[model samples]
Target: MARRQVNPRDLDLVIAAVHAVDPCPADQEAAWTDRVRERAVSLYVLGDTVGQDIARLDAAKQFTATLLDVRVEASSTRGVLVLRNTSGSSSSSSGPTAAIPRPGGR
Candidate 1:
């Protein structure tokens, strides 16, 4: 018996497939966003190297961007990091480790 190593690309494909299935109902938008973030992070940790693939990463970013965009469009006040500081929170891990975003704009 032998343990087989999974290719990083295969993880990305799995994450992509997860997104395609629409895990949550329409009214449960937050849950849907959470799912995407969770899957994205798992993909990242699995060595997906999204930065190396602009198009694929861009698709992931769009999910976060849309969440932010909706907040802005609503004209309601909400802190981006404050809202997402949990499991699917936006943080240093979301971006390049070498150039992390500073808190409160430094």
Candidate 2:
């Protein structure tokens, strides 16, 4: 009976991820980035149903962060975005966005 709004932090997190993965080559236009961003958000939103862990919006501010930090920063490294926790517990979120290290130190 109501339309559920997606989280803004969810968006911020996804966009950061898109920038890291696609980085928009010089040849690409705004449309390309838009598409990429849209796709990223869609995927992230669908994470729970897609069988992935969900992170807290406030905990992850950087392109990558552990489950206590929430600050954004520029990053090219691929990683998972995890929710920040005051302390580690077996009951992890609904988490995780992180910058996975490049293979062979690429």
Candidate 3:
């Protein structure tokens, strides 16, 4: 496959554009791909951020919006997507998040 480019507002497109591989290799029908279908309210927090992992999981059950602007650092305006290491430490943190404006502008 060739390189692909996308914007935050158009991230939902990846759900359909993803290909199949591994244990649940169903391409667009994969379970992993299904989770992020509603990118606007997807919950993804730092895996090494103590209770945040479980908190994020619980919030997912109710379709809440968290991890909206996980930054690279305290002073950064950019966002990040974090991953865990073999020992449950923060291995990497990159990428951005997608979320539509909240209702009532709150």
Candidate 4:
């Protein structure tokens, strides 16, 4: 039996699907994020270099990290996720990773 090759685009779809779903209970959120992160890493490790899959995987990892941060903030604040830009810096010296705001304020 042969293993099937996984596409990096599929991982993007998975991330979008996860984002589309309503927030799960706080207890389960970590598991979901962990699983997604693990899958993304695994795909990255197994992906071929011909298609720039590595770059896509890197983007996915960043997206996953931002998602996890948002989930944690939402859970901690009881669903109110507030994002503030500090000092108009493009990159943060230290702090949480910047997240893209969801449309319609989520």
Q: Note the Cα lDDT for every prediction shown.
A: 0.51, 0.55, 0.43, 0.50
Sorted on TM-score, best first, the list reads: 2, 1, 4, 3
Candidate 3 Cα deviation (angstroms), residue 64: 21
> Please, what are the lDDT tens digits per residue for candidate 4 over residues 1-106?
9999878687675675566555566789887776666665555455555357657657763311121123323433223323344443232222233344445555
Clashing pairs in 1: none
Q: After TM-score superposition, what is the CA distance of residue 92 in candidate 4 from its true location, in Å?
A: 60
Top candidate when judged by lDDT against the true structure? 2
Q: Model 1: runs farther than 4 Å from truth?
A: 1-21, 48-106
Residue range 40-86, candidate 1, lDDT tens digits: 66666655455657656566642331132112112323233213333
Ranking of all candidate structures by their lDDT, best first:
2, 1, 4, 3
Best by TM-score: 2
The TM-score measured for candidate 2 stands at 0.28
- Candidate 2 lDDT, tens digit per residue, 1-106? 9999988977776766676565666877786778777777767677665544334544545433255433332354454344544454322232133344556664
2, model 3: CA deviation in Å? Answer: 36
